[model samples]
Target: MNIVLFEPEIPYNTGNIGRTCVATNTKLHLIEPLGFSLDQKEIKRAGLDYWPKLNYEVYKSFDDFMEKNNHPKVWMATTKAHKVYSDVTYGSDDYIMFGPESRGIPEEILVDHEEECVRIPMFEDTRSINLCNSAAIVLFEALRQNHFEGLNLSGELHKLHWND
Candidate 1:
């Protein structure tokens, strides 16, 4: 699975998400005009020295990303949605896109991919979850639904046991 961040603002959140990608062996794509430089101390601090170890790609623009990836479908996480994330069947090649903290994706883009939009269930009056946390929650569910096979850590499958 892939994680795509569109115009992310917070360095620490991006750093945290980068670390998540590294740990899960997921490819991370950052769409640009980022609020801070990639080498910003705040990003490196949260991501730590292992940031370099993560498999990540930087796209100059969303158009550039679409041109290259051409993902069959993109599952966008938005609050203005009727369907829950668990309602859809996630594929291995699907691109899961998230928007900036302050503002969600533009109306044009969201409307363009309206059929693929999804939202996590939440209690009333709650705004949204943290970017990194939301990404983790969605990604793990996608992986789980796919039986958690074919992932980089699959080889260590035998090591996963339930003590309970």
Candidate 2:
């Protein structure tokens, strides 16, 4: 799976997303004009020791990203969509894109790909969910639909065994 961030402005969110991507073995694509430098301490601090292992690339633009990645199968997450994310069948290599913290993916782009857009169900009064949380929610659903391939499904306690 892949996670693409369009013009991400928050380093902490990006950092935390990066850590999640690393843990999930997912690739991350970042579009440029980023609000914070990749070298920022905040990003590193949030990513902790996992940033080094993260597979990520920065793109000059969305067009550059599409052209370079050969136009991957992407699902855009936005508040303006009819379908729920889990309704769509996700391939293992599918890309899930989220927009900037403040604005979100451009309306023009969303209009062009309306069929591929998805939204989490939320109350009409609220604005939107947090970026990192939304990503995890949709991603985990995708992972679950695919039976969480190559991921650990269980764990052991440090000093106790469940079978004891």
> Stretches of candidate 1 above 4 Å error?
150-164
How displaced is residue 62 in candidate 1, in Å? 1.5
Pairs of residues at least 3 apart in sequence or in different chains that clash in candidate 1: none
Query: Which candidate tops lDDT?
Result: 2
Q: In candidate 1, residue 132 scores what lDDT?
A: 88
Candidate 1 overall lDDT versus native: 0.87
- lDDT (tens digit, per residue) of candidate 1 on 1-164: 88999999999999999988887778898998798999999999988877999898899998899988864578989987667888899998788899998997777889888888889888999999999899999998888888776656535445656795
TM-score of each: 0.88, 0.95
Residue lDDT tens for model 2, 1-164: 99999999999999999999999999999999899999999999989999999999999999999999999889999999999988999988899999999999999989988998999999878889999999999888888888999999999878867797
> What would the TM-score be for candidate 1 when compared with the true structure?
0.88
